[model samples]
Target: MNVLFLGKIQYALYRLVLAETPEAYLLQTHTLPSDLNFMPTLGNGHLGYTVFGDAIFMNGVYNGAGGNSKRARIPNWLNISAVVCDRFGCATDDDELSTTNDTLYEMDLRDGYFRYRKDYKKLGITLEQRSYPHKYFNRALVYEVVASRHATTARSNAPQFLKLSQHPGIASDAFEFVVLNNGSNAKGDYRVIRGRTQVLEFERFQPQPHEIYILFSQSLEEPLQIEWPTWQMEITHRIIICIDREQSVALKDLQDALELNFQDLHQKHIKRWHDFWDNDFSIRIAGNSLELWQIANAGIFYLASSLPSLTTNQKNEPFDGLSPTGLGRGNLEADYQGHSFWDTEIWMLPVVTQFGYDYAKEVLEYRSRKLEAAKYNAYAKGYKGARYPWESAYTGTEVTNPCCPEVAQQEIHISADISFALQKFFAQSADFDWTCDKAWPIAAEVAEFLVSRAACEELKQVCHFLNVMGPDEDHANVDDNVYTNAMAKIALEFAVWAGGMCGNASTELFEKWQQVSNRLLILRDVDLDYHPQHEGYKLNTEVKQADTILLGYPLRFDKSSTHLNDLKYYANATRESGPAMTWSMFAANYLRTSEDWRADEYFERGYKSYVRPEFKVWSETPIGYEGSANFLTGIGGFLQALIFGYGGLDFYRSGNQTTMENSGVLMPPNVEEVEINYIRYGDSKCRWIYKSHSSFMDCGYRKSGKKFEMLQGNKRTLLATNFNVTHRKGDPPIYINLMN
Candidate 1:
């Protein structure tokens, strides 16, 4: 037996970057956030609240004027979180504390659970609590934890007296705070705060029209005189925060919540989350960087949490809209003051549209609902039809901070961005009825506005959007911005088709749209072989972020020979201080090109420095830079890189092609195999895997109109919505599997 040793066993334990189990969809750490923005957050679409911090913001809820306007923090429902005392010197006991007994916090993105654990080692007791917002509900947050002394603690000889004071309820109001005296009750726990939640506006600090209902309770009666102080004690507590526009409605909803089993509600919450994770065309890499897997989910979780789950039959069906910072940041000057920007329509749309068309529809509807405001904006600006503001808040009016009036004045492309997104939505969903009813109207107005806005030579094909800012904010006013003009063309073209689908357009209108689409200046430099950012654009001229390269992406503009050159050139011009999203666009654009040389490098740069460690919360700028926290804009961009870039799924028709679909999968050489799920709004999901393999180009070339986007591959199988391939090196003429 001693002579028969066959192989060496190093016994080096392999650790997973993220757990493969459901538990892997969790954030657990003992590190405390030096910046509170790093804390985990929860939202029910309408309301955005944090688990451990004080920021609470409602969608479309703004209070103040000019730069002071903010997503005002309403009265804190958890006024005094919790307090526990013992025989020795008293130390405050808070489960929400970032660190306690080496286990500070655990956030399960799966079920939206935020867990907190506190230990009293000397006191021989432990406090564990978990909370989650009913992500599907309009405004429902549930917090629950049960604790009691163990029966095995009978060995204790001495008894101890413990007072747990939970001064729970709303506090800090712009109106009035009156403490109600509940004379006497056998139950040690009690409710203290009451009445309407008055959130004051910034200018006057006066109460707003919205009202919130706050309720708190405990599972056990308070003043427990323990027979033995050393007895293992446990207790259960629950808190439910319900908010509404009317006081009565909030109260009624709270009462209804109390009637149902909290556990059952929690289960429903978990199910809704699965609806997103299960079929939303995400990924599961067999052997690759778990970092992307983790990030994609985190970005989706944060983005989805801030969205109203339309699955529920809640009264407030659709939320206002999503902002750049999402539900994570508000009130603080750091937030976007709950304002919706192009971030919503473009940055956030791809993932939501793939995961839940219902959510995507609601996002478009948010704009349609505010069509009148857009019309007003156009009229005030001396234009026709509609002009969506750069930053829109409650009233859908331009709420672009007064500090930066240039954005509101010159970022006119936001309107076209909306139409572009709507077009993508229609193409992906193929929902004709929605297009006719909702999307058509929006496109019609936007097209009319653009026709009026653009300075086109009458009956000619030369037009320019003058004195407008491109995606690069550094250049405030530029002429014929290629990105803006191309997006406007897409919007105009969408209007043409949307009207045709609805049978509500004139032939002249169709001609006008085509004329503009054909004539809109897509500024190009034949000498440089690249599309200029705008007229008079100079090389390496310090762009703020993604600008001209966008034509190949969200705009779905036909790609030219200069597409790759444009991406490469901008890669140099873009400043290092650019936001997290810029790199993603560069990555996706490169991957789409026939010559995708720097695709891998750009893909890594997309998320490398922007994603924070311990928790994958993204920074508006690279980590350690001064910028907003939980930047969904960047998250959305990163997702686009994964879903469309690495995944190679197209949302818009390309280069005169009529269909709004394309799939060209690619992965880094280091990756062995990666599966991508294609989930368009109304289309059947398409899923396939890409493994490192080779002669893929020959197969794609043989196929008439199909384009294959892999570095190397031979065998091609028509599986689902993709050309599934299994390439073998130097082995066969070609292996093709056509699955019917």
Candidate 2:
């Protein structure tokens, strides 16, 4: 199988082929039939379910809880499983399975549904299944199962039983199953509800006092007995699973879900997916490379699905935000523990911010909700202000594995990461009021912590941050990490700048922040041309990932030749197996330095290594480890490589002009053209078209109602008013030329 055309290859290359084996299965296979690691999963941001052949082996939701024991804290609940059986008894795992035939198995990316069909020729029975998670309904997953006669002469006494298994855990005893029939109601003729009990555990906080409930109901279009001497040509069944920590809520949601027509729900799900693709930013490269387009689309889909909407209940929720491994219920021990890391603010949130501001606001609000917990954590450690935990889960407590104390205790950059995200959101959105009201407080507190964390060497006129861990987890407990100090400097400066804007500037705090920002000790070599990853990093040239080079991209600091040398140095030293975001950082930095060819090369390399072969989603590592498949941080980095790197887009406010700054389209020499359509930058929608000789850019603002200028390199061009141009709600598409 070709690697470039993985997911949508068959569809792209040959229109006649109905189905092909999913790339996921072709690239990675499980030796054991029962291994859930290689299963395909579907979710609607809140609930996730894994599909194995025709059965759903594991179904779970993002709930803050342990599996069975208090010490084994599982932030998700693996609740239900479903399998098919005939009158002869349940079918074994060997029952033929294939997703290679279009008529047999199909995963519709546009419709957000998976369908599979299997034929038992000897048994004269055929089974088809279609499954999808409802986009609008947060609590429900829908599965449609069909059983039909294989041939006209196919006569059999085999009655199919769609076994719905409710397995909560080993420690819970509260389990109930019930079957109900709607009298004369065509849509809700027969239904079965299964409920199970579970427990929730927190490492440093009190466990949830209530019993968690997992409820699922199976509704059928036609009823069937345990045995049937005669069967119809086809019979259809619909199953819906509704999960909640509270039994009452689960029951209510289940009933509400049961009341909806199956066809309507499925249609709504399709529409939701379409709206996501239409409203959010989209990229259409001019090429037959289906992999590139599919990867980008899949990234957006995975990132959106992994995040919890604002409607989700936050109380007793396991950080109920975003997790490193998403809401997947992997092996009990191999689970990611549903913890949020610095990855959320630094890598993931930027992508979310670009797609929609409301979603971005919700992410920030989640952090705000945990502010008090962060403060308590800092105070407990005898630090001022708030110090976010390196691994934060429910209650925002430090939940890092006990064995990895360096990550939990010494990665002080987590605080700076939060501050940086807040500042980025503020600067990009230009919502000064919201920043002042909501984000500034957090930034101010983080600034306080940074000031306290830094030790000022008065004689040397430098503030040193010692014994800290940067993004590179390989190097632990290191001193003066360049990434840490650079981000810290930005955090402190933002706090002071935002404080004055909000009329809450502290004179002493400002002085301290300014002093630290100016004197922050960045570990540089003897020549002061290339910054080291950390102090003593020069001794052994084994850099873990993009540490010092980060100063050039997201930080947008060091733009000098020294920064270029550091980028070159780390480019050679960084490990290939480092985090997925590392390569994209290199791509972005190269783009900033006008090295278009290298930027494009690194972008392609990053996309190939970071993305999964089957789903085109990003995992932690290229080799498919136990991490979030949708890994938003890597997605954000990849997007930065495209939008910020090649498109040359950045946000800045200068001299009464608050607008997106562009360095024109930096097309690589190898590529003839590149185009990005409908990129959401703040309140505006931007489109860029670049060719070998010239580039065209258009910016349209829909909400701000403020006219913004585009700075192409050194030239500033005001977008023409909609009255004189194509208008989208009175916001005209402002066109500018970079090469003219």
| lDDT per residue (tens digit) for residues 1-740 in model 2 | 76534523432343232134233222222232233443445666556655442222122222234222212222222333435466566654465431122235445565666666666655566666677666666666676665656565345545446554444334323233233333234564324343332444344454433334445464233332323335545455566665555556656666766676545556666667666656665555555555666676666666676654334322223325566555543223334555667878877787777767777886787788788888878899888899988876556667676657777888999899898888777667777779888888999889888888888899999988888888877888788998999999988888888888889747987988888899998877857578888887763477667778889878887888888888778888887777778888898888877454677778877778766555555666676344444456777778777667776666643322345555556654245566666655556566766654455656665653555444333555665432112212112223332111
* Candidate 1 weakest lDDT stretch, 10 residues: 6-15
Number of backbone clashes in candidate 1: 16
TM, every model:
0.83, 0.80
**Candidate 2 local lDDT, residue 233:** 51
Report the lDDT tens digits of candidate 1 across residue range 241-308: 66555545555555566666645555667777777677554566555566666776677788877877
Error of 2 at 597 (Å): 1.8
| Clash pairs, model 2 backbone | 18-102, 19-100, 19-101, 19-102, 20-100, 66-74, 325-628
TM-score between model 2 and native: 0.80
In lDDT terms, which candidate is top? 1
Error of 1 at 197 (Å): 9.1
lDDT of each: 0.66, 0.62
